[model samples]
Target: MPGKSGEIIDYIKNDLERDPQDIKTIVVTHHHFDHTGILDKLKKITGAKVAIHSADADYISGEKTQHGSLFMIPIVMFMKIIYRSRPVKADILLEDGDQIGDYRVIHTPGHTSGSICLYNPINKVLFVGDNLMYSNDKIEGPRVVHEPENYKKSIEKLRNLDMGVILTGHEQPITSGANNRLDTFLTELYD
Candidate 1:
């Protein structure tokens, strides 16, 4: 973090009274530029280990360009113009069932090849990163997916979990009744 962006560092020091070094790991949910744009810079400042799913590690490592639909080309380019992507290697390659802190990694691929959801069984909170959306009292799937079949399976996988809270990558979080919201969404999705 440099220039105006260093405010994150400043906030940590001034508000939280904590050092950037306190950060131990940077967990990335996918390869989207919006999620990983400043990852390289942040990693440098905090000296944190970068963790990303193995399927998407190459994109973060700059070994391969992000794969997406043709419609996303323009959106991706726009992201590049607004926020430059700085590739950084992942220190830990994660997979399904891996535990990061108190969260269990659920590989819900579809939105991206390595899209994931972090489930905390203790709190019954699920962190669905772009694999699902919650807004206007509704739970919806991603608008676009790289693999439609995988997306359906991912939704099915979520159905088996006992989720009370849903923290989404975008839109407001579903703070309660997460299971019911997901059920309604699934019904609508299938219909």
Candidate 2:
């Protein structure tokens, strides 16, 4: 699910309310509004550093427009007009294989030209942001892609990895045997 700002703030507030001593870090897989909506608020509330891939840095820094579909143009225009663009700066710019806490950055672009995934080797969890989705016990490739070839390559890369849990940005989260399902989907793409 796209982490909205209000929801994210509430989530952090609840976390801190439960344990004020806990360390927090908001790891955004990309700069999409849905993923970044509460980013600034979460950073302020938890005093957590925001991390994003360097390839998307320009877009987040307000230097470039966010890549969006033609269908999303009206909504983007509305957001630009109604909401003052509070350009967010990432505390840490990530690179492929870079570690954030227990998670490793996986540059899986194509969904937005700068998309990424977070993989935790110990937990075997893959936090894929829109690069992949789960539905009906299956792993589905991206619904939209700015670069189809790159997206396909990303899916193949992820399929090769050892993952047990697939936490997608949308739809239900897959808890077990996710890697196998993802591999099947990738293989089918070739056939």
Candidate 3:
């Protein structure tokens, strides 16, 4: 939700010409440093309630620490030096099937223990944060290796959803045939 350098707050206040305080809530997909780089600052400015899955709430709040894979150790250390995660206390603890405004929270844990996807049933749009990525004209799973079993199951759950547009945390969105793109990604995953 928060871009690096906490510029998103400025964009919301200046470019969007809106009061950050009017924001009802801030939804966090996970507690990864990249996703949460500016979260604490944003919350302070917006005075918005923070919502995150229970599994990751502690880590984000600085009550617990996160451990990455052996391969990610260096990357995590670098993030610590560069980004310096700020602790955030979640006002609302989310779970699968929970509704936040018009979006339904779908627990898609793989990239992180509390990773989630927000599906808007009315518009049929899904915001998948790092659970799936758009790459090379194809839909793909998380780039980093985490919980493969959970990742596969998460993708399968998405396969059952009636999605129109697929928005991801990074890269371009899949505007058309989201299910088809997901299907292709699934096939690749299973193979």
Candidate 4:
């Protein structure tokens, strides 16, 4: 989990209440605070195993140094506090093709060097974390907050998938039939 706090757990609890048995595993697209904020708490509450990419296991497990931009300081601090209060450990180390429930984990490294996206082919939904961001009717490349080249590659990788919905990590969700929009945005990045 990202921060492993109580507020995040409440949000998950409400969702679980709506469909208690529907969710099988709690998958962390990456170790970012916003995505993983309630991971450990949710796991304890739901008894569902927590899954994260193996590449990020060390970072999330506090075995490696956490590096990021100035804006990420708060997240790092939050993580430190959470870890101090209640240390968390991932129950499952996920791989590129590992399936969690109906979604497959696609390791789209760029945003965090170990970032991932959960692709559900049946629903044509992708839970992409910082790989792409949507704004003003356009699904564009991620902000130049980290490695721009890797970010561009990740955008291209995600664009090739037959996705109907793009659930980004930081912004509002992008609806179906937006592949062309994403393609154009990625093309602009390449150009």
Question: What's the true lDDT of residue 114 in model 1?
Answer: 89
After aligning candidate 4 to the native by TM-score, how far in Å is the CA of 17 from where it should be? 3.8
**Which digits, one per residue and each the tens of the lDDT, describe model 3 over residues 69-184?**
78766776566666655688899999999999999999988888888999998999999988888888888767774677688888788898899998898889899888888888
Steric overlap count per candidate: 0, 2, 0, 2
Q: Show the colliding residue pairs in model 2.
A: 1-169, 5-38
Q: Of 1 and 3, which scores higher on TM-score? A: 3
**Ranking, lDDT, top scorer first:** 1, 3, 2, 4
Candidate 1 lDDT over 51-119, as tens digits, reads 989999998887988777788778876766666656699999999999999999999899988888899
Off by over 4 Å in 3: 1-6, 74-84
Worst 10-residue lDDT window, candidate 4? 15-24
**Candidate 1, residue 8: lDDT:** 71
- lDDT for each of the candidates? 0.85, 0.75, 0.83, 0.72
lDDT of 2 by residue, 26-90 (tens): 67788777666545555665677777889887776778777778888678656755655466788
Deviation in angstroms for 128 in model 4? 0.6
Model 1 global lDDT (CA atoms, 0 to 1)? 0.85
lDDT of 4 by residue, 1-191 (tens): 44445555556567555443344677777776666655656666667777788877776676765567777777677665857533358888988788887888888777776788888889999898877788888876665444555676666667777888889877889896668888788778778
Instruction: List TM-score per model, in order.
Output: 0.88, 0.87, 0.89, 0.81
Kindly indicate the candidate among 1 and 4 with the higher lDDT: 1
**Residue 33 lDDT (model 2):** 70
Q: What count of clashes does model 3 give?
A: 0
Candidate 2 lDDT (Cα, whole model)? 0.75
Error of 2 at 65 (Å): 0.8
